[model samples]
Target: MRHPSPSSWAVISICIVAIVHLALGFSFGFSVDEAHYALYAQHLAWSYFDHPPLVGWIQWPLIALTTSEGVIRLIPEALWLISVSLVYRITLELHDVIQGRSSGYLTNVLPSGPSCGLMATLAVIAAPLPHVLSIGLLPDTLLTPLSLGLMLMALRWLRKERFSLGDWIITGVLLGLAGLSKYTAVFTVVALLMVFLSAKRKPWINQPGFWLAGIIACVLISPVFYWNWVNDWISFKYQIAHGAGGTWALRRVAAFIGIQIACFGPLMVVGVYFFLKQGWRNHRLTLLALLSFFFVPFTIFAALSGGGSLPHWTTPAWFCLAPFIGIGLAKAWSQQRRRLISSLFIVQIALCLIGFGFVLAGGPPSANLKANPMADLYGWQSAGQKAAELAHANNATGIAVQNWTLGSRAAWYAQPLPVYVLDQRQDQFDLWFGQLPLGANVILLNWSGLSYVPPTGKGAGFESCRLLDSLETRRFGQLLSTFDFSLCTNWRGADLVR
Candidate 1:
């Protein structure tokens, strides 16, 4: 036999990593967020109550394929390839820029040139926070790549110091796509604007590319804006409240920083080392560009810490960080400290394996509490199926649940069950399905608890709402959760309950 070339090994590595992620996706049950997004797949919309339509749009085709929790996760995980490709292109471009045309091809002959891009790819998928959380169907899954693409385009425009109308349009389109994925993408536009107005780049703004990118981006996102207007800006308002969940605390800001540390881990160490030793002062434009590109996403999420925000709001920043890490590792190759980068890979992989260990060991410490904040993913598939059988048996005209998560989860797991959310919040379902007919029979899954019963009073959307049966989601014969069931003999209601 023959030894595989480095290129052969690279292809093999990508396949192996891809297979592992697919296995991991299957290993866990649907997260509450996954369940919610899976619900989004059911009803096509211009925009949703809680988010823009792209996540759902991504899942729309998959609806025909399968709804199994693990399979649903693939919608985002498959996108990992795109993320890596963008990173590689950008890294390769940056490498060429820094080294110059004279040295570019000569360096490409060496192993490190190509491998830097691969390293960046691995850094992203291997990182624990984004890697694990990204598996579940989520907006960040799409947003991260679009964010990187937006940055890459902006970088290209600036690196050349030329307007290139084509570059601006592509940048605008990518920015639009990113916004569709997540509003945090607005930061990319801010970054571009900041760059356009900077001292060296100021003249570039007078060109059509400057204003056209903004206009095209706005035109691209017009659907969401129009949707917001029609829906009373519910998505924007929801995001505002959600981003700032509580009063500001300096500790949260600190915690957000700490999360980046944990998420980036040893790579963060290498990044700091590169900056300190390499002294980025020489690459001021590149550094300024990198910082500005990162500032929008990081600041948007980080600033909200005063109100309340999670550290991962800076998830796309990881996309930005990867190329920097890649460039650092590439430089290390010349100095023979390349082993440091290899060691970081081992540590990151080990950390992810440990995370997988915890996830696979599903039962939480106490069933009385939300287990690992992921308990919803477990035990609910079977319950949802059973609820569907019960609803069908009772001749239910509609299956109603009290909240979005349960409603979405139940709808997916319970095939043929047209689940309606009967909560104060109006999600995609209400907009499409509208009110259940007056005097219609309903099987209400009492989300409150086992002992609860719905109001039987006239015009409370029920002629009579009585507890029918209760199902206990148990683990090893211990009750994890108990949900009361109600059979509303004749639901009388139109429009949402206030």
Candidate 2:
């Protein structure tokens, strides 16, 4: 039998991955982030407190039409596939740049353009974090492809002496869309600037099209500024405090590095080594562009890891490096390292399967329900429904959670009823539901995973409170979490009742 071409293999890989993502989406409940972003759809706004509005705007139509978690997930799955295709396109661009080079070593090492593109696509699929993004939509999900598009445009511009009007417009629109996707996209703008300033010819600096691109991007991102202006810049303040809030710790930095290797897979690590070895000599400009995109945000996040940072914040940076990594891996395949490359792919596949198994099983039974990380994703659906029912039974005006993290799931699963966070911190929930009015009744939900006590004394927020129901959530006959619903009346705010 004849073997499939590299392009054919890429298509097959994408199809298979899509099917897997769809299955996972159907099998699991909405994750904490997923539910939070989905709630953004229900309440359409210029922007959100934690993120820009594109994530919610993209799903608004689907949310209006249906509430199925699986269907909502289709959006992210499609975005993931788009990101994969963009990576393939970027690999091809890299191949063309390398092929145009005079260096014999660079020319001899990399496989054909099609083969390089295939390897890059495969690298994205094998990565663990991309799979998670595919299963659930987040701000990063939308930003991934937009960031890749900006990188591709940068490469195309590098091929020419000057950028045309159309090129400038396209670049601006992509940058704008990226800004609308997430705040992290500012790194993309910085990367683009680095590429322009580092270029052999810098005449684009004096060009009219360049200024036009700036105006267009600013116009497109005006909503973020507009929303912040009206809201007293609360979102900006919150993000600043959030990212820089934690104390510095060496262990956090180490954990961050470990997560990058684990999520991106071991093969990409080898690929990075190869790129560093030959990239400077063979493709200096290309190396600079790719590295700027990858390292700018990556270095910031790594430094922030000592203070605090989420692993997924660097996803766009990892994606920006995919094309180069693809080329490196393709070279490895060309050399006699096929077995080693294959083993890495096998390990990645095994890790993906294990991750899915853990989700399906709703966390290990041996673990404490409160301590199980998977417990966050397992019990929200049941708990939300119980909260809603209890609220109705007790004639409560709304549902309350002690933390903002818990409000999203409750708000989403409970539907039109308002969900409020009883905590002191102001967040999206506070903006949406406002302070639960003084002397109002509410159904308080406390999950074993993130339990909190409802205050009921003379100095407490509530006048009186009693347990309404306890919901037990299980998967494969193993209890994953329990949620306690309490009916509390006459909330006098979180102050002494005089």
Best by TM-score: 2
What's the residue-level lDDT of 440 in candidate 1? 79
Best by lDDT: 2
Tens digits of per-residue lDDT for model 2 on 1-498?
A: 189999999999999989989998998788889999998888899998999999999999999999899999999999998899999999998787778752232544467989989988888888998889988998998988999999999888877766899999999899899999999899999998888876655588789999999999999999999999999998899888888848999899999999889888998888777656664565576567667899999998998899888888888888889898888888878878799888999999899888888887887779888878887887787788888888888889999888878888999889788998886777899888898898899999988987776877875789888997898988888888898988899998876422
The C-alpha RMSD of each candidate to the native structure, in angstroms, is: 4.5, 2.2
Evaluate candidate 1 by giving its C-alpha RMSD to the native, one decimal. Answer: 4.5
lDDT of 1 by residue, 214-309 (tens): 898788788899999998998898887787788888888888777777886767457536633665444555556655776677776777876777
Question: TM-scores across all candidates?
Answer: 0.82, 0.96
State, as a TM-score between 0 and 1, how close model 1 is to the true structure.
0.82
Off by over 4 Å in 1: 1-11, 27-29, 65-71, 102-111, 161-163, 198-203, 209-212, 330-344, 361-369, 415-442, 446-498
> Model 2 reaches what TM-score against the true structure?
0.96
